[model samples]
Target: MSLPTPLTAEAEDSAGRRTDVLVTVLAFTGIAVALVQTLIIPIIPHLPEYLHASASDAAWALTATLLCGAVATPVMGRLGDMYGKRRMLLVGVAMLVVGSVICALSESLAPMIVGRALQGLAHGVIPLGVSILRDEVPAARLPVSTAVMLGSLGVGGALGLPGSAMIADAFDWHILFWTSAALGALALLLVMLFVPESKARPGGRVDIPGAVGMGISLICLLFVVSKGADWGWSSGTTLGVLAVALIVLPFWGWFELRTPQPMVDLRASAHPQILFTHLAGVAFGFSLFALNLVLPQVLQLPKITGYGLGESLATAGLAMAPQGMVMMAVAPLSARVTKTRGPKTTLMIGAVTVGVGYLLIMVLMSATWTLILASCVVAMGVGFGYAALPTLVMSSVPASQTAAANSLNTLMRSIGTTTSSALAGVLLAHMTIDFHGVELPSENGLRAVLALGVGAAALALAVASFIPRHRPDAAVTPADAIAEKVGLRPAADAD
Candidate 1:
């Protein structure tokens, strides 16, 4: 966390300007990428008619994006560490622009899926942006900058939903992609103009074979989790993929351990500080995503269902938008808590807040205002947890490993979210009541899912509690990291 103390006043002035530009551009880029993820949600059910495809076939549009993003996140992060973080960042955003254009122009299922896969490649931007800030920004501004950047993940997705829903309602669905393309282009221009390439490049060739092995294993594992309900969990195809993942993962771990430049450093990951933080990431992710699954359905279902409020898609989106604003508002608190109480305490507070929010949701979802209040409460917890996670990772690992390490942490959250989606789908499908000719999720089923969310948040709090206390020397500068181990932070002071 040490700095050069700005050898001269003029140099300090220029440094301050660059720091401002860097933080601003990175936060905008994070929002741009996150917005693209949710932009397609409003149109998912109508995708079959829009592309003249079967319902099963149309679902691939969303599935493809998740798979591509899962694989691309860590791979691109490793590439960033080797080449340059800002360079890989630009490449990621460029893919988003290209993907948006393809989706905007598409008239068939194949092109839309391809475009989605391209958009997914941009998922690495958030982690890479954090890594770049670590390298280029001053120690004092680092915590706040990282909090703002991380909060953008929630902000972009929350805001995008209503905006995209409105666009789809008013115009051709293709207009949504066109709008996304325009935003991507704007982000590209800003990054190119303001963000500089990080000088903290690691020296090593990429572990091509290791990367391939890791990618294949992840694709299989996530495919089972994401599509098992549709594919029949016990079917041969699903069983075979599950079996392949189980077998391949162990071998992949073995290979990575032996390889000179591993895709993920197993030895380092095994450290308690990094390990518990990642486990917390998964649990925290699972807790937050249940809100997304439950709110939209309650808002859009038939009012005759008694429990359903019967709002339109656009209105449902608006109902959830406050969560983003809550996350943004909590960003500065994330910085303040981390600086004073230590990231471990901040993360613990977040997990408790998420648990309490879910406890309220289990009772308070009878009305829209109550639901929105519950969502905002959960989002405040997420902002705190998300901001603290990268801080913990960066503090624990060396500067050279920041991109790879943070990317892996992000992937862990994706795994949690995917699992939550699958779990909710199962609960709702089996626990349904007949309304007219259709079966719909019963109120009890929704409560069961919210109860699960509460459990996950509790688990996250438990995991966060296990993180080892930080020593004063936890964060070594990039220059210091080159010659020695990372610095550990001192015990927390009474700030």
Candidate 2:
């Protein structure tokens, strides 16, 4: 075969600039989307007062986001694959901006839940961005680029805690959502200016029936997990939702199995490599979110409780800020590891590190510095695992299906996080001690949660260990090969 023509110097420089702009914009977009998850966390305890609602009702602010995100992620991914990734990405970002504005103006629970749910719809941006990178980035640079994108999730979440806490302390809480709106607007502008629409349109009809079925099942499952404690585990509402989830799952499976262009493509997902990766995603999700739940509470609780640090919200946030930095710093290194040892090995290493971090928290919880140290350790592991999970997922699936596949992986992690929150809530609630007329979480309660985190980490490692070893190269679509051959990508990365 004849060799392809080389790009001219100016053309090559232009391609480099475009690639740089694309990666940066998409990574920022991911971070922008992620910030929504943590923005309300600082104000959760006070939500009842602000919204003129009962504690049980105020909790729906968090649950709304989780439920909406769980349902939206996979659907958006499939839509991106069918329509255009860039188009669907823009829609997600726009929803975030709109959601934030509604939240900023809200004075009651109803609007706040609506705003938060809209924000949750944007969760698809990160995975969609991953799929975009798979379609657009040069094969040689894919690992490190993908690592940075995945790392953005940790960075955004890590920074959001401290940042939102400080804002809540200093200003009206409305400012929190306003800030998110501004960030979302910025991400939207950057995407419009720099990010190009992907050319890999695996055009097909959307599985609307499948989407509806899956959405209903996810809503039921997440509703039961998030509200079961408040509704009473044995209550009719909880049991009814749980029963609906169980009942719908089998039917959903049956429908998806029969559909020609199913939303999830269950047949491909059944492969040992993909199946195990998704399971590992759930384990790591539980592992990561458990730290988020435990650290802030342990740091902010009254010192009279003996195990509490009694720090201000802002201080606790500042202490944990290092974790996000550590996550960003370690992500490139994880990419390097993926290049040398494989993504599976990198993930296993992350699991062990996370478990060690939780172990440290158990043994050393008296000082803020120790919490910082332990959390940073956990962040390092998160950086490694988060970066690797998507890599493993994208590598195993067809390029055209990358968005849907990655979204499903993300959904698994969401399931893990929601489950972690529920279990932690239950443990902390019943395991409380009476402190001067108020019930406070006992030391053992906190330890039990930490122990759960350690167990989650170990579970992640075990699940990752079962991932079938494979070559690192991702399957390229014919369009990708054509684009690369025509000098649309950088030759420098080919080194």
Candidate 3:
């Protein structure tokens, strides 16, 4: 065959512009999906009244979403690997739109819970987005693109809180879901218009049994972690679910190890570098969520409590909003550090920064501005840490396995956040001071949670330190090999 002609300067420029559009759209889609997580936080207190249900029943609106997201993350990742990442991503965003509409039109708890559960599936977008970047974005641009895309998690979550609060404060509560639906629809449209399908398919049949086993185990485990406090730690229901998860996990692993095309590659994950990266992901998750929990409580509690800031919910959200902006700002910086010192160093720095932020929070909780400053510090750490995680995973795994590996990593973080929420809840629940006739979380309890945040950051830093150092020239991943073969990279560089 005749040699394929190289692109002209104008064609290359057009390609560059397309790549930019792809990254921008993907990042926007990530932020839109993430918004679902915090959309209900502002209206949580009034959920029971709106649904005409008991408080315990209404809590399912939150719990269902968490459980669905946990179940969906790994399964969706596996499917994306088998099929097409962009196709799966579109499906995920579609679920968000449908779920949001269901929630918007709901008059009772059942439909609301269903809608939230559907929205949870959108969590898969982030991992799949990162994987797509690996497949399509030029290697030079990959780091910054992935960093910004990953940081959208923090961005959407931070912006959503105050935006949702302000909207809820002024309009009917249904407007929140309506707004979510609109955003999801817009993201879905933009994604279809801009993001290209990934070519790195590691052709494999779905591991049906493995998926089912893993899903059941995760659901049971996460359910217990998230609801154990309210259900009573010793309650049979909680213990039973916990027991099921514990029993199912070993079997799931055993089956996965034997399967030729496993839903999750246990061997790859067990490698020290990938394993440590995952452990660090958990630590980062705990730190991020713990900060989310403690800061808001400290900000919104009655001012009569010596430690509380006594701000309204909207104001508290606005104060926290700067952290999201900081995270976005730190993304490019994270990419720079990853490019220079390596992702391991980036993660370590992030861990240290996060620890310092938590320390600041402990000392600075008395004032809103101080708390904002401390949260911004934590956001910086989270941005750096989140950006580093996928880069590390992608570097180690084959291009074909990126989505699955990244999904598992994301799942680890979810587990960490869930554990943090549980621990913080228990501490705040038991350590409360009487404010008039009601009990409120005591300063000591909140302080303990903040201390745990510090401990989590330290744990992440320690775990990240153990990750094997990456030398760009020393490793050629499957993706790199493919890119080289396909002329996506210069042959000299490939060698």
The prediction achieving the highest lDDT against the true structure is 3
Candidate 2 segments exceeding 4 Å error: 1-13, 473-480, 487-495
Q: List TM-score per model, in order.
A: 0.94, 0.95, 0.96
Which candidate tops TM-score?
3
The lDDT, on a scale of 0 to 1, for candidate 2 is: 0.88
Q: Each prediction's Cα lDDT score? A: 0.88, 0.88, 0.89
- For each of the candidates, the C-alpha root-mean-square deviation to the true structure, in angstroms, is 3.8, 2.5, 2.5
For 1-495, candidate 2 gives per-residue lDDT tens digits of 233345545665666677778889998998888789889988998999999999989988988888889999999999998888999999999999999999999999999999999999999999999889888776656778888898888778878988998899899999999999999999999999888887878799989999999999999998888888888999999999999989999999999999899988889999998999999999988987778888888999988778899998889888878887888788678888887888999999999999999999888799999888988998899888888898898888877788999999999998998899899999999899998899988889989999998999999999999998876554453334755677654333575
Q: Which should have the higher TM-score, number 1 or number 3?
A: 3
Q: What digit string (tens of lDDT, one per residue) describes model 3 on residues 403-435? A: 999999999999999999998999899999988
Clash pairs (backbone) in predicted model 3 = none
160: Cα error in model 2, Å: 1.4
lDDT of candidate 1 vs native? 0.88
The superposed Cα distance between candidate 1 and the true structure at residue 90, in angstroms, equals: 0.7
What's the distance in Å from true for residue 421, model 3? 0.3
Better of 2 and 3 by lDDT: 3
What TM value does model 3 have?
Answer: 0.96
